[model samples]
Target: MSDSKHRHKSVLKKTDEELLTDDLTHQLALHTRQGHNKFLSESIIPLMLCFACPFFVRSIVFICDHCHGSIHEFLQRLLFDHTLTLKDVLENFFFFKWHWPSAIIIIGFLIYAIIMTMLLPGDEYQGPITDTGHIPIYRNNGFCYYIVSLIIFTILTVVLKLNNLSPTYIYDQWDAFLSTVSTFAFLLCFCVMIKGKYMPSTNDHRSSSNWLTDFYRGVELYPRIFNIDVKLITNCRYGMLSWALLSVIFCMKTFELYGYTDSALITCILTLVYLTKFFWWESGYMKTIDIIVDRAGFYLCWGCLVWVSGIYTLPCYFLVTHPKQLGFQLTILILTLGLLSIYINYDCDRQKIQVRSTHGKCLIWGKPAKIIRAKYRLLNGKESESILLASGYWVLSRHFHYIPELALAFLWTCPCGFQYILPYFYVIILFILLMHRAHRDDQRCRLKYGDAWIKYCDLTPWKVWPKIY
Candidate 1:
């Protein structure tokens, strides 16, 4: 106990950055101790809390009512209201009547996700279904459910607000709750439905003439035009679309909460516009818009969009709708930060691409030279060589691009405010996810590049960012 207390005191005395680093180390240590099952255990508690909190509060209210004039008054009447228990105090404000349907849905989804995570193979596979000869299964299911749920939830929320129903009524805005549950459901399903085992590895060295032609041309022209290559474009579009849609929903709900002019229409239009841009630009214009993105692009884009927009924009929309609930200055600050981050990230990517295209070879400090060659095997057993330009941005940091990427994520999520535990959840999750991805990429490189990778790592030690990370 004494040792533990001393350690706690030492941690408390550290600078904020040091403390945060320590916390991260502690979290990673815990994961190491617990193994991969740590994810399951970490998630189980939150899932339970989401369902259990409402029930726990309801039970307390029920018991309080039996002996009291009013639960609040009774609590106040006893031991001085100031001395009320933390549970009683929380029950007073964030109380909600338990809804069996929502609870069951949440629990069911949680269970399904756990099963899928445990049972599914880790190997990548082609999706079972295709749209226009493209691998569209993940996005199709995720987006379809997201759109359907948003429509249903919006309609229900409008009806409830018009009827002057209490916000605490579970059915009032049940769609938001349900959509949350369903998103997890699909994510779980995606994990379980791995088809990648049958699919060829990206690293396989083969000729492009036969198999590449078939794989690329098997899809219809329209889909093929959208750059739906299995090796490059993964299932990130679905995640991005889902997050953008969810943001609109949150914005609409915020407008409703504030009794302001209905902005749902505007929000919907913006969402559609972004989705269209994403499909058009991300799908086909990768080389035009920016370069260097590969399979990782899909995950990076979607992860940032969904996690940040979902957590930050949604709650802020509610607060905006109910301005009394949140301060105006803080809201503006968050929005500004998001805009800044986005601009920086986009500009950085553009500069990198433009420099590479214009120079033909990457230039570092006016010196032009090649560091390494990338060997790609086509589907038909032919080998091709592409130079890996390690000079320009690549020389600065191993993964310089990730710096702006993470910054953008932080900016998008910062607007969610510091008032609730839920808002900060995305930040925590993203940090861990990105770190794990970096580690995986490192392992892949170690296997593929052998000695060359060691040299590259030595030259550019930083993985995601410079110095700090």
Candidate 2:
């Protein structure tokens, strides 16, 4: 306990630069001895809190009297009237909602995604090495698959509408989607708890003896079911596909209700384009922090399955009911600005990737790319070399890419106007997410690159914003 206390104090005594560099990397030693699962208590709790969002969205946004209504009443009564016991709270929210139609939809979609993954044209990418000696290879066909899926979806929608056979009640799929995904997550957890034959991820800490913690952390680094990569299927195909489709449906519903309004249209167009861009840059994403560092745990799996499709569609989701007509001039300006931000972000990422690919031999902004050679040790003890580009957008701010990305998110979100707080939820979340990611990436490099990281940080001082942050 004394040693742990001293270590914590010593960390606090470091300089601001050192602190920023070392932030989030140093896991404080726990004084209390616990099972392996309990070791991740710090991480698991935050993830659990994030879990609340799905239920909140499903219950509140898409209100069902049987489920959320009772829960809300219970909460209000407890807060303003009487105290509630633990059993009361659990019982209040524990009714099963079996939307048989949505079940078919979810199952059919999964089957469709698997078929598309098999048929689509994609390059096999070798990711960063893993604890298991095998290097992870993923088939990235999201762009082609998404395009084909969208076309087929459109044709079906059109065909059904012409014959007046369209499934209108399908609009209520959000609640059902939430319920079905929750079941999948729980079942996955149970599977992970019992199955030890799979290749589990190896990390700094030992495996937790606690079943729930082990399940929460995941039993496999990469779980393959019926020859499908769970991460790729859940994160890219199911989540991204659902998010995009939901936005489309919301916009269509808005048009059906209020003729044609530019506000909803603008949001819809930007969202579709943004999602398409994501698919186009799918390979680039395969090497990101989420895929490379994060385990295939509940944080990621449930997030991609449930939270992503719900929360990410908020801007357009709100617009479905509250359609406003922004004039042509304002619409043009917003679109122009958004497209520009998207371009800047894409180009910035392209420059960094190209320079690294070319070993700093390429030109950046009409000048030779300048970079500091930095070496880092992988989690598995293998050494890797990377050159930090100090020229172009990176020199302006270490995370200049985030600025344009933020701009892009904000401009699209502006269509919601100042009338309601719900639409701007994405903008606020994006800001926090970016800032947190910047800190995490910096800390990771500080641990990995050591002195080389310090030098790199010195060269480009500003983390994101110009001279402010």
Writing each residue's lDDT as its tens digit, candidate 2 over 1-469 gives 8986576667756653454344232222111112244445745664565456554556444422232324455566556665655555443333335567777887788889988998887878876654323467778788999999999989988998999766434555655656766666656556643543334433322244555555565555566666677778878988898888888888887778788989988888888888888888877777777776555666678778767776788777777666789999999999988888888888888888899789999899999998999865443445667789998999988899999888888888888888556567678888998898887777666655678888888888888997986
After superposition, candidate 2 runs with Cα above 4 Å error: 1-40, 43-51, 59-96, 131-134, 189-206, 379-381
Tell how far residue 379 is off in model 1, in angstroms. Answer: 8.9
Candidate 1 on 1-469: residue-level lDDT in tens? 8986577556545543343235333222222222244444334543454445334323332332333313445455445755556675455424433446655644653343334323433333333111112333122232233345456556866787789953334324443343443344334323222222133223211122232222211212112112233222223333444445456555555555555432333333433543443443342333321212122211232223223333434333333322332255654564555455555544445445545456445455467644665443322334443344466567667666566556655554444334443434445665776677677666544433445566677777777777865
> Where does candidate 1 have its weakest 10-residue lDDT segment?
216-225
